[model samples]
Target: PDCEKNVKTLVDGFAAEGSPIVLVRHDSGDPESPLHPDRAGNAFKPALDGVEPALVVPKHVHSAFHGEVDLHAWLRREEIGEILVCGIQTNRCCETTARLGGDLGYDVGFVIDATHTFDEPAQNGRDALGADLLAQATATNLHGHFANVTTTAEVLGAIPAAG
Candidate 1:
Protein backbone atom coordinates (compact mmCIF):
# COMPACT_ATOMS: atom_id res chain seq x y z
CA PRO A 1 0.00 0.00 0.00
CA ASP A 2 0.95 3.67 0.12
CA CYS A 3 2.21 3.14 3.69
CA GLU A 4 5.37 1.45 2.48
CA LYS A 5 6.05 4.27 0.03
CA ASN A 6 5.15 7.01 2.48
CA VAL A 7 7.25 5.51 5.29
CA LYS A 8 10.18 5.13 2.91
CA THR A 9 9.96 8.76 1.90
CA LEU A 10 9.79 9.92 5.49
CA VAL A 11 12.71 7.75 6.52
CA ASP A 12 14.78 9.10 3.63
CA GLY A 13 13.86 12.64 4.58
CA PHE A 14 14.99 12.04 8.16
CA ALA A 15 18.19 10.45 6.95
CA ALA A 16 18.84 13.52 4.80
CA GLU A 17 18.37 15.66 7.87
CA GLY A 18 20.92 13.56 9.75
CA SER A 19 18.29 12.62 12.28
CA PRO A 20 18.60 9.29 14.05
CA ILE A 21 15.69 7.07 13.09
CA VAL A 22 14.68 4.32 15.49
CA LEU A 23 13.20 1.16 13.98
CA VAL A 24 10.89 -0.70 16.31
CA ARG A 25 9.69 -4.18 15.42
CA HIS A 26 7.06 -6.17 17.26
CA ASP A 27 8.17 -9.62 18.39
CA SER A 28 5.26 -11.57 19.82
CA GLY A 29 7.85 -14.13 21.06
CA ASP A 30 5.49 -17.00 20.19
CA PRO A 31 7.38 -19.32 17.89
CA GLU A 32 4.15 -20.18 16.10
CA SER A 33 3.25 -16.56 15.53
CA PRO A 34 4.44 -15.11 12.24
CA LEU A 35 5.05 -11.86 14.07
CA HIS A 36 8.06 -13.35 15.75
CA PRO A 37 11.24 -11.66 14.55
CA ASP A 38 12.58 -15.05 13.55
CA ARG A 39 9.76 -15.36 11.06
CA ALA A 40 10.00 -13.90 7.55
CA GLY A 41 6.78 -12.00 8.10
CA ASN A 42 8.48 -9.91 10.78
CA ALA A 43 11.41 -8.94 8.60
CA PHE A 44 11.99 -5.32 7.83
CA LYS A 45 10.70 -4.14 4.49
CA PRO A 46 12.99 -3.59 1.50
CA ALA A 47 12.24 0.11 1.74
CA LEU A 48 14.13 0.08 5.07
CA ASP A 49 17.27 -1.19 3.39
CA GLY A 50 20.43 0.89 3.97
CA VAL A 51 18.55 2.83 6.64
CA GLU A 52 20.38 1.93 9.80
CA PRO A 53 18.45 2.86 12.89
CA ALA A 54 20.13 4.58 15.79
CA LEU A 55 18.42 1.94 17.86
CA VAL A 56 16.61 -1.28 16.99
CA VAL A 57 13.90 -1.81 19.57
CA PRO A 58 12.18 -5.19 19.65
CA LYS A 59 8.92 -4.69 21.44
CA HIS A 60 6.17 -7.11 22.37
CA VAL A 61 3.69 -4.46 23.43
CA HIS A 62 1.91 -2.00 21.22
CA SER A 63 3.61 0.95 22.93
CA ALA A 64 7.27 1.13 22.11
CA PHE A 65 8.02 3.02 25.33
CA HIS A 66 6.53 0.27 27.44
CA GLY A 67 8.76 -2.37 25.96
CA GLU A 68 11.72 -3.94 27.71
CA VAL A 69 14.00 -1.61 25.76
CA ASP A 70 14.85 1.48 27.74
CA LEU A 71 13.76 3.95 25.10
CA HIS A 72 13.03 6.65 27.65
CA ALA A 73 16.45 6.28 29.21
CA TRP A 74 18.13 6.42 25.83
CA LEU A 75 16.21 9.55 24.90
CA ARG A 76 17.14 11.13 28.19
CA ARG A 77 20.78 10.23 27.78
CA GLU A 78 20.73 11.78 24.33
CA GLU A 79 18.75 14.76 25.65
CA ILE A 80 16.21 14.38 22.86
CA GLY A 81 13.06 16.16 23.89
CA GLU A 82 10.81 15.69 20.89
CA ILE A 83 9.82 12.71 18.81
CA LEU A 84 8.08 12.23 15.46
CA VAL A 85 6.04 9.05 15.79
CA CYS A 86 4.85 7.37 12.60
CA GLY A 87 4.23 3.84 11.41
CA ILE A 88 1.59 1.21 10.69
CA GLN A 89 -1.66 0.71 12.64
CA THR A 90 -2.52 4.35 13.16
CA ASN A 91 -4.92 3.60 16.00
CA ARG A 92 -2.74 1.00 17.68
CA CYS A 93 1.03 1.16 18.11
CA CYS A 94 1.40 4.61 16.60
CA GLU A 95 -1.30 6.08 18.81
CA THR A 96 -0.07 4.22 21.87
CA THR A 97 3.45 5.55 21.49
CA ALA A 98 2.25 9.08 20.89
CA ARG A 99 0.17 9.04 24.05
CA LEU A 100 2.94 7.53 26.12
CA GLY A 101 5.55 9.90 24.70
CA GLY A 102 3.45 12.88 25.69
CA ASP A 103 3.04 11.46 29.18
CA LEU A 104 6.79 11.06 29.30
CA GLY A 105 7.11 14.83 28.72
CA TYR A 106 8.26 14.69 25.14
CA ASP A 107 6.74 16.84 22.45
CA VAL A 108 5.26 14.41 19.94
CA GLY A 109 4.64 15.09 16.29
CA PHE A 110 2.34 12.45 14.86
CA VAL A 111 2.59 12.19 11.09
CA ILE A 112 -0.94 11.21 10.28
CA ASP A 113 -0.50 10.99 6.54
CA ALA A 114 2.56 8.80 6.92
CA THR A 115 0.67 6.23 9.00
CA HIS A 116 -1.89 3.58 7.99
CA THR A 117 -4.41 1.15 9.53
CA PHE A 118 -6.70 -1.74 8.68
CA ASP A 119 -10.48 -1.67 8.54
CA GLU A 120 -12.61 -3.20 11.31
CA PRO A 121 -16.21 -4.22 11.26
CA ALA A 122 -18.68 -2.09 13.18
CA GLN A 123 -19.80 -3.22 16.63
CA ASN A 124 -23.12 -4.29 15.15
CA GLY A 125 -21.31 -5.90 12.20
CA ARG A 126 -23.20 -3.63 9.88
CA ASP A 127 -20.17 -2.18 8.06
CA ALA A 128 -16.43 -1.86 8.20
CA LEU A 129 -14.71 1.35 9.17
CA GLY A 130 -12.40 2.34 6.35
CA ALA A 131 -8.74 2.92 6.90
CA ASP A 132 -9.07 6.60 6.22
CA LEU A 133 -11.83 6.92 8.77
CA LEU A 134 -9.73 5.13 11.38
CA ALA A 135 -6.81 7.42 10.63
CA GLN A 136 -9.01 10.48 11.14
CA ALA A 137 -10.23 9.15 14.44
CA THR A 138 -6.67 8.54 15.57
CA ALA A 139 -5.74 12.09 14.65
CA THR A 140 -8.65 13.43 16.63
CA ASN A 141 -7.62 11.51 19.71
CA LEU A 142 -3.95 12.51 19.47
CA HIS A 143 -4.22 16.11 18.36
CA GLY A 144 -3.90 18.77 21.08
CA HIS A 145 -3.76 16.10 23.75
CA PHE A 146 -1.21 13.43 23.03
CA ALA A 147 0.53 15.01 20.06
CA ASN A 148 0.32 17.40 17.14
CA VAL A 149 -0.97 15.50 14.13
CA THR A 150 0.75 16.58 10.91
CA THR A 151 1.91 15.18 7.59
CA THR A 152 5.17 13.92 6.14
CA ALA A 153 5.57 16.91 3.85
CA GLU A 154 5.06 19.32 6.70
CA VAL A 155 7.58 17.53 8.89
CA LEU A 156 10.16 17.31 6.11
CA GLY A 157 9.65 20.98 5.34
CA ALA A 158 10.10 21.93 8.97
CA ILE A 159 13.45 20.21 9.45
CA PRO A 160 16.44 21.55 7.56
CA ALA A 161 18.33 19.02 5.48
CA ALA A 162 21.81 18.00 6.57
CA GLY A 163 24.64 19.85 4.88
Candidate 2:
Protein backbone atom coordinates (compact mmCIF):
# COMPACT_ATOMS: atom_id res chain seq x y z
CA PRO A 1 0.00 0.00 0.00
CA ASP A 2 2.76 2.40 1.00
CA CYS A 3 5.13 1.19 -1.71
CA GLU A 4 3.98 3.66 -4.38
CA LYS A 5 4.06 6.54 -1.95
CA ASN A 6 7.52 5.69 -0.72
CA VAL A 7 8.82 5.21 -4.26
CA LYS A 8 7.47 8.60 -5.25
CA THR A 9 9.02 10.17 -2.18
CA LEU A 10 12.40 8.64 -2.95
CA VAL A 11 12.21 9.60 -6.61
CA ASP A 12 11.26 13.17 -5.77
CA GLY A 13 13.98 13.47 -3.16
CA PHE A 14 16.68 12.19 -5.48
CA ALA A 15 15.42 14.19 -8.43
CA ALA A 16 15.56 17.33 -6.31
CA GLU A 17 19.27 16.67 -5.81
CA GLY A 18 19.76 16.23 -9.58
CA SER A 19 20.42 12.55 -9.15
CA PRO A 20 20.04 10.37 -12.23
CA ILE A 21 16.83 8.37 -11.92
CA VAL A 22 16.67 5.24 -14.05
CA LEU A 23 13.25 3.75 -14.56
CA VAL A 24 13.02 0.14 -15.67
CA ARG A 25 9.90 -1.24 -17.34
CA HIS A 26 9.26 -4.89 -18.09
CA ASP A 27 8.18 -5.48 -21.68
CA SER A 28 6.84 -8.91 -22.35
CA GLY A 29 7.09 -10.48 -25.82
CA ASP A 30 3.63 -12.00 -25.73
CA PRO A 31 0.96 -9.56 -26.89
CA GLU A 32 -1.49 -11.06 -24.45
CA SER A 33 0.75 -10.36 -21.48
CA PRO A 34 -0.19 -7.40 -19.37
CA LEU A 35 3.42 -6.24 -19.45
CA HIS A 36 3.52 -6.24 -23.25
CA PRO A 37 4.90 -3.04 -24.75
CA ASP A 38 1.53 -2.17 -26.28
CA ARG A 39 -0.40 -2.76 -23.07
CA ALA A 40 -1.33 0.02 -20.66
CA GLY A 41 -0.12 -2.12 -17.76
CA ASN A 42 3.43 -1.69 -19.05
CA ALA A 43 3.40 1.98 -18.17
CA PHE A 44 4.81 3.27 -14.96
CA LYS A 45 2.65 3.77 -11.88
CA PRO A 46 0.34 6.80 -11.59
CA ALA A 47 2.52 8.07 -8.77
CA LEU A 48 5.35 8.59 -11.27
CA ASP A 49 3.16 10.21 -13.90
CA GLY A 50 4.93 13.57 -14.00
CA VAL A 51 8.37 12.34 -12.98
CA GLU A 52 10.98 12.24 -15.72
CA PRO A 53 13.77 9.73 -15.32
CA ALA A 54 17.29 10.16 -16.67
CA LEU A 55 16.89 6.84 -18.40
CA VAL A 56 13.98 4.52 -19.19
CA VAL A 57 15.15 0.95 -19.66
CA PRO A 58 12.94 -1.60 -21.36
CA LYS A 59 13.67 -5.02 -19.93
CA HIS A 60 12.34 -8.49 -20.68
CA VAL A 61 14.21 -10.18 -17.84
CA HIS A 62 14.12 -9.73 -14.07
CA SER A 63 17.38 -7.83 -13.70
CA ALA A 64 17.39 -4.35 -15.18
CA PHE A 65 21.08 -4.75 -15.98
CA HIS A 66 20.18 -7.22 -18.73
CA GLY A 67 17.82 -4.87 -20.48
CA GLU A 68 17.91 -3.47 -24.03
CA VAL A 69 19.95 -0.56 -22.75
CA ASP A 70 23.30 -1.15 -21.15
CA LEU A 71 22.48 0.01 -17.65
CA HIS A 72 25.97 -0.59 -16.33
CA ALA A 73 27.62 1.14 -19.27
CA TRP A 74 25.33 4.13 -18.88
CA LEU A 75 26.03 4.35 -15.18
CA ARG A 76 29.73 4.18 -15.83
CA ARG A 77 29.49 6.79 -18.55
CA GLU A 78 27.65 9.04 -16.11
CA GLU A 79 30.10 8.09 -13.33
CA ILE A 80 27.38 6.72 -11.08
CA GLY A 81 29.01 4.48 -8.51
CA GLU A 82 26.00 4.00 -6.28
CA ILE A 83 22.41 3.07 -7.01
CA LEU A 84 19.10 2.99 -5.14
CA VAL A 85 16.74 0.16 -6.12
CA CYS A 86 12.95 0.21 -5.64
CA GLY A 87 10.17 -1.44 -7.63
CA ILE A 88 7.48 -4.14 -7.86
CA GLN A 89 7.99 -7.77 -6.91
CA THR A 90 10.36 -7.11 -4.06
CA ASN A 91 11.64 -10.68 -4.06
CA ARG A 92 11.99 -10.90 -7.83
CA CYS A 93 13.12 -7.99 -10.02
CA CYS A 94 14.25 -5.81 -7.14
CA GLU A 95 16.19 -8.62 -5.51
CA THR A 96 17.78 -9.69 -8.79
CA THR A 97 18.92 -6.17 -9.58
CA ALA A 98 20.40 -5.71 -6.11
CA ARG A 99 22.29 -8.97 -6.32
CA LEU A 100 23.64 -8.17 -9.79
CA GLY A 101 24.50 -4.63 -8.75
CA GLY A 102 26.54 -5.98 -5.86
CA ASP A 103 28.28 -8.38 -8.22
CA LEU A 104 29.06 -5.47 -10.54
CA GLY A 105 30.75 -3.66 -7.61
CA TYR A 106 28.21 -0.86 -7.34
CA ASP A 107 27.09 0.43 -3.99
CA VAL A 108 23.47 -0.73 -3.95
CA GLY A 109 20.78 0.50 -1.63
CA PHE A 110 17.62 -1.58 -1.64
CA VAL A 111 14.71 0.58 -0.52
CA ILE A 112 12.81 -2.05 1.44
CA ASP A 113 9.50 -0.26 1.89
CA ALA A 114 9.56 1.16 -1.61
CA THR A 115 9.29 -2.34 -3.07
CA HIS A 116 6.58 -4.95 -2.61
CA THR A 117 5.42 -8.41 -3.76
CA PHE A 118 2.49 -10.81 -3.56
CA ASP A 119 2.07 -14.13 -1.78
CA GLU A 120 3.08 -17.22 -3.72
CA PRO A 121 2.18 -20.87 -3.34
CA ALA A 122 5.05 -23.04 -2.20
CA GLN A 123 6.64 -25.24 -4.84
CA ASN A 124 6.71 -28.24 -2.50
CA GLY A 125 2.96 -28.21 -1.93
CA ARG A 126 3.21 -26.39 1.39
CA ASP A 127 1.05 -23.43 2.39
CA ALA A 128 1.39 -20.23 0.43
CA LEU A 129 4.11 -17.87 1.55
CA GLY A 130 2.81 -14.54 2.73
CA ALA A 131 3.93 -11.29 1.11
CA ASP A 132 5.16 -9.98 4.45
CA LEU A 133 7.27 -13.09 4.92
CA LEU A 134 8.73 -12.78 1.41
CA ALA A 135 9.54 -9.13 1.95
CA GLN A 136 11.28 -9.88 5.22
CA ALA A 137 13.26 -12.67 3.62
CA THR A 138 14.35 -10.39 0.80
CA ALA A 139 15.56 -7.85 3.33
CA THR A 140 17.48 -10.45 5.30
CA ASN A 141 19.09 -11.87 2.19
CA LEU A 142 20.18 -8.52 0.79
CA HIS A 143 21.07 -6.57 3.92
CA GLY A 144 24.83 -6.48 4.52
CA HIS A 145 25.31 -8.83 1.58
CA PHE A 146 23.88 -7.76 -1.77
CA ALA A 147 22.68 -4.30 -0.78
CA ASN A 148 22.05 -1.98 2.13
CA VAL A 149 18.38 -2.50 2.91
CA THR A 150 16.85 0.83 3.91
CA THR A 151 13.68 2.93 4.09
CA THR A 152 12.46 5.91 2.09
CA ALA A 153 13.00 8.30 5.00
CA GLU A 154 16.57 7.15 5.43
CA VAL A 155 17.32 7.60 1.73
CA LEU A 156 15.73 11.03 1.66
CA GLY A 157 17.73 12.08 4.67
CA ALA A 158 20.95 10.96 3.01
CA ILE A 159 20.49 13.10 -0.09
CA PRO A 160 22.23 16.46 0.03
CA ALA A 161 20.04 19.52 -0.12
CA ALA A 162 19.81 21.40 -3.41
CA GLY A 163 22.23 24.30 -3.48
Candidate 3:
Protein backbone atom coordinates (compact mmCIF):
# COMPACT_ATOMS: atom_id res chain seq x y z
CA PRO A 1 0.00 0.00 0.00
CA ASP A 2 1.04 3.58 -0.52
CA CYS A 3 0.72 4.25 3.16
CA GLU A 4 3.30 1.64 4.02
CA LYS A 5 5.79 3.00 1.54
CA ASN A 6 5.05 6.53 2.67
CA VAL A 7 5.52 5.52 6.28
CA LYS A 8 8.89 4.03 5.44
CA THR A 9 9.82 7.24 3.72
CA LEU A 10 8.68 9.15 6.76
CA VAL A 11 10.67 6.89 9.06
CA ASP A 12 13.69 7.45 6.89
CA GLY A 13 13.06 11.17 6.81
CA PHE A 14 12.97 11.23 10.58
CA ALA A 15 16.28 9.44 10.65
CA ALA A 16 17.76 11.97 8.28
CA GLU A 17 16.60 14.63 10.67
CA GLY A 18 18.31 12.82 13.51
CA SER A 19 15.00 12.03 15.17
CA PRO A 20 14.85 8.94 17.31
CA ILE A 21 12.39 6.42 15.88
CA VAL A 22 10.74 4.37 18.58
CA LEU A 23 9.42 0.97 17.58
CA VAL A 24 7.00 -0.96 19.77
CA ARG A 25 7.18 -4.73 19.25
CA HIS A 26 4.37 -6.79 20.74
CA ASP A 27 4.91 -10.41 21.79
CA SER A 28 2.21 -13.06 21.59
CA GLY A 29 3.54 -16.10 23.38
CA ASP A 30 0.82 -16.97 25.90
CA PRO A 31 -2.81 -16.59 24.96
CA GLU A 32 -3.40 -15.55 28.55
CA SER A 33 -0.92 -12.77 27.98
CA PRO A 34 -2.38 -9.63 26.38
CA LEU A 35 -0.58 -9.80 23.04
CA HIS A 36 0.91 -13.22 23.70
CA PRO A 37 0.98 -16.46 21.71
CA ASP A 38 -0.04 -15.42 18.21
CA ARG A 39 0.20 -11.69 18.62
CA ALA A 40 3.81 -11.08 19.61
CA GLY A 41 6.25 -9.44 17.20
CA ASN A 42 3.34 -9.06 14.81
CA ALA A 43 3.39 -5.37 15.48
CA PHE A 44 5.40 -4.80 12.33
CA LYS A 45 3.86 -5.52 8.97
CA PRO A 46 5.34 -5.90 5.46
CA ALA A 47 4.71 -2.21 4.87
CA LEU A 48 7.69 -1.44 7.02
CA ASP A 49 9.60 -2.85 4.04
CA GLY A 50 12.66 -3.94 5.97
CA VAL A 51 13.26 -0.55 7.49
CA GLU A 52 15.68 -0.87 10.39
CA PRO A 53 14.18 -0.35 13.80
CA ALA A 54 15.68 2.21 16.15
CA LEU A 55 14.20 0.98 19.41
CA VAL A 56 12.24 -2.21 19.88
CA VAL A 57 9.90 -2.25 22.86
CA PRO A 58 8.93 -5.86 23.51
CA LYS A 59 5.46 -5.53 24.97
CA HIS A 60 3.57 -8.57 26.19
CA VAL A 61 0.44 -6.51 26.66
CA HIS A 62 -1.81 -4.50 24.39
CA SER A 63 -0.40 -1.26 25.61
CA ALA A 64 3.23 -0.62 24.75
CA PHE A 65 3.43 1.46 27.91
CA HIS A 66 3.46 -1.75 29.88
CA GLY A 67 6.31 -4.22 30.56
CA GLU A 68 9.38 -2.05 30.04
CA VAL A 69 7.93 0.02 27.22
CA ASP A 70 9.48 2.82 29.28
CA LEU A 71 8.09 5.06 26.58
CA HIS A 72 7.57 7.91 28.96
CA ALA A 73 11.07 7.72 30.33
CA TRP A 74 12.48 7.32 26.86
CA LEU A 75 10.56 10.32 25.64
CA ARG A 76 11.93 12.39 28.51
CA ARG A 77 15.45 11.23 27.91
CA GLU A 78 15.22 12.16 24.26
CA GLU A 79 13.53 15.46 25.05
CA ILE A 80 10.71 14.51 22.76
CA GLY A 81 7.29 16.08 23.15
CA GLU A 82 5.56 14.53 20.19
CA ILE A 83 5.35 10.92 19.07
CA LEU A 84 4.65 9.46 15.67
CA VAL A 85 2.98 6.20 16.71
CA CYS A 86 2.95 3.62 13.94
CA GLY A 87 2.77 -0.19 14.11
CA ILE A 88 0.54 -3.25 13.71
CA GLN A 89 -2.65 -4.49 15.34
CA THR A 90 -4.19 -1.07 15.22
CA ASN A 91 -7.08 -1.71 17.59
CA ARG A 92 -4.76 -3.10 20.23
CA CYS A 93 -1.25 -1.71 20.64
CA CYS A 94 -1.91 1.36 18.56
CA GLU A 95 -4.93 2.31 20.58
CA THR A 96 -3.43 1.41 23.93
CA THR A 97 -0.15 3.13 23.19
CA ALA A 98 -1.82 6.32 22.01
CA ARG A 99 -3.91 6.61 25.17
CA LEU A 100 -0.90 5.96 27.33
CA GLY A 101 1.11 8.47 25.35
CA GLY A 102 -1.48 11.12 26.00
CA ASP A 103 -1.54 10.31 29.69
CA LEU A 104 2.20 10.74 29.80
CA GLY A 105 2.01 14.23 28.25
CA TYR A 106 3.32 13.46 24.76
CA ASP A 107 1.55 14.67 21.67
CA VAL A 108 0.46 11.42 20.10
CA GLY A 109 -0.13 10.99 16.41
CA PHE A 110 -1.31 8.00 14.41
CA VAL A 111 -0.53 6.81 10.91
CA ILE A 112 -3.78 5.00 10.39
CA ASP A 113 -3.00 3.24 7.11
CA ALA A 114 0.55 2.44 8.11
CA THR A 115 -0.77 0.00 10.72
CA HIS A 116 -3.00 -3.06 10.34
CA THR A 117 -4.33 -6.29 11.98
CA PHE A 118 -6.43 -9.40 11.60
CA ASP A 119 -9.81 -9.35 13.28
CA GLU A 120 -10.73 -12.40 15.32
CA PRO A 121 -12.56 -15.31 13.64
CA ALA A 122 -15.60 -13.83 15.29
CA GLN A 123 -15.69 -11.28 12.46
CA ASN A 124 -15.89 -13.93 9.73
CA GLY A 125 -12.92 -13.84 7.41
CA ARG A 126 -13.61 -17.56 7.12
CA ASP A 127 -12.16 -18.10 10.56
CA ALA A 128 -9.54 -15.51 9.77
CA LEU A 129 -8.84 -12.33 11.74
CA GLY A 130 -10.52 -9.33 10.12
CA ALA A 131 -7.83 -6.69 10.35
CA ASP A 132 -10.06 -4.41 8.32
CA LEU A 133 -12.60 -4.35 11.12
CA LEU A 134 -9.97 -3.88 13.78
CA ALA A 135 -8.31 -1.05 11.92
CA GLN A 136 -11.60 0.71 11.43
CA ALA A 137 -12.53 0.22 15.06
CA THR A 138 -9.24 1.66 16.16
CA ALA A 139 -9.61 4.63 13.86
CA THR A 140 -13.04 5.35 15.24
CA ASN A 141 -12.03 5.06 18.87
CA LEU A 142 -8.64 6.74 18.66
CA HIS A 143 -9.48 9.67 16.39
CA GLY A 144 -11.20 11.64 19.12
CA HIS A 145 -10.93 9.23 22.00
CA PHE A 146 -7.20 9.62 22.56
CA ALA A 147 -4.95 10.77 19.75
CA ASN A 148 -5.25 12.32 16.35
CA VAL A 149 -5.13 9.69 13.62
CA THR A 150 -3.78 10.99 10.34
CA THR A 151 -2.49 9.65 7.07
CA THR A 152 1.19 9.30 6.23
CA ALA A 153 1.06 11.89 3.47
CA GLU A 154 -0.73 14.43 5.60
CA VAL A 155 1.65 13.80 8.47
CA LEU A 156 4.73 14.08 6.28
CA GLY A 157 3.42 17.23 4.72
CA ALA A 158 2.84 18.61 8.17
CA ILE A 159 6.50 18.26 9.01
CA PRO A 160 8.18 21.64 8.98
CA ALA A 161 10.96 20.96 6.49
CA ALA A 162 9.07 18.35 4.53
CA GLY A 163 6.84 21.13 3.31
Q: Say which candidate scores most in lDDT.
A: 2
Give the Å error, residue 7, model 1: 1.5
Candidate 2 per-residue lDDT over residues 1-163, each given as its tens digit: 6999999988888888888889999999999998998999998999898888899999999999999999999999999999999989899999999999999999999999999899999888888999999999999999999899999888887777722
lDDT by residue (tens digit), candidate 1, 87-144: 8779999999999999999999999877878998988889899888989899999999
Q: Count the backbone clashes (under 3 Å) in each candidate.
A: 0, 0, 12
Ranking by lDDT: 2, 1, 3
Better of 2 and 3 by TM-score: 2
Which should have the higher lDDT, number 1 or number 3? 1
lDDT of model 3, residue 48: 57
Candidate 3 residue lDDT tens string, 54-162 = 6777776878778566767776887889987776657777788898887777788888877766647765556664677778778888787678889888887877767
Error of 1 at 95 (Å): 0.4
> What's the C-alpha lDDT at position 138 in model 1?
93
Clashes of 2: 0
What C-alpha RMSD separates each model from the true structure? 1.9, 1.5, 4.2
- Measured against the true structure, the TM-scores of the candidates, in listed sequence, are 0.91, 0.96, 0.76
Instruction: Look at candidate 2 and give me any clashing residue pairs.
Output: none
- So what's the TM-score on candidate 1? 0.91
After superposing candidate 2, which stretches have Cα over 4 Å from the reference? Answer: none
